[model samples]
Target: MRLEFVENGPIRLEGGRFRVRVGEREEVLEKPRLSLCRCGASANKPFCDGTHKRIGFQAPGGVLEVEGD
Candidate 1:
């Protein structure tokens, strides 16, 4: 799967299997596409849940840490 860092937003996951792990919890995703939370404002924790849009989340320009790197 390839992760594209979208401008001023979350990381977009395109096509692949993913194991989303946060502490002791883990979620397996086999979807073709998905958006991950980066603003740390989602009520859904690791998942996007679309809270970023409402909060007007703007990503600062810098190096982005790759997920599952």
Candidate 2:
């Protein structure tokens, strides 16, 4: 499984259950496709609760820029 950030929107998850550590807690998901919140306003915590759509999130078009080469 792999996780990819979708510009300004959410983190896209592909494949099966992957482990993630948050603070001291570990989270495992069973879904193959999921959108994770990045704006820190999601009521659902790790998952996107459609707050981005309500807040009018404008994700960058098809390009990702990583800092510091």
Candidate 3:
């Protein structure tokens, strides 16, 4: 599994087994790829609808690493 925090855009996930849960509902992602919203402007919460581009959302994007992994 790999995750990419796109430059000034959504978070991209690929080649992973994952699940999404909201309240009492849960869904196992059927697709290997997904774009999750990082900017709070997306109408589709938790998913990217390309709203960041329209709203001029800015964020530092890159891979995050933990020490002593």
Best by lDDT: 3
Stretches off by above 4 angstroms in model 2 are: 1-8, 63-69
Worst 10 residues of 1 by lDDT: 60-69
Using all chains and alpha carbons, the TM-scores for the candidates as numbered come to 0.68, 0.63, 0.80
> What lDDT does each candidate get?
0.75, 0.74, 0.85
For residue 12, model 3's alpha carbon misses the true position, in angstroms, by 0.8
- Which structure is stronger by TM-score: 1 or 2? 1
- Residues 1-69, candidate 3: write the lDDT tens digits: 667899999998885576999789888877878899999989988899999999999998887433444
Q: Which ten residues in a row have the lowest lDDT in candidate 2?
A: 60-69
Candidate 2 pairs with clashing backbones: none
Question: Whole-model lDDT, candidate 2?
Answer: 0.74
Q: List the residue pairs that clash in candidate 1.
A: none
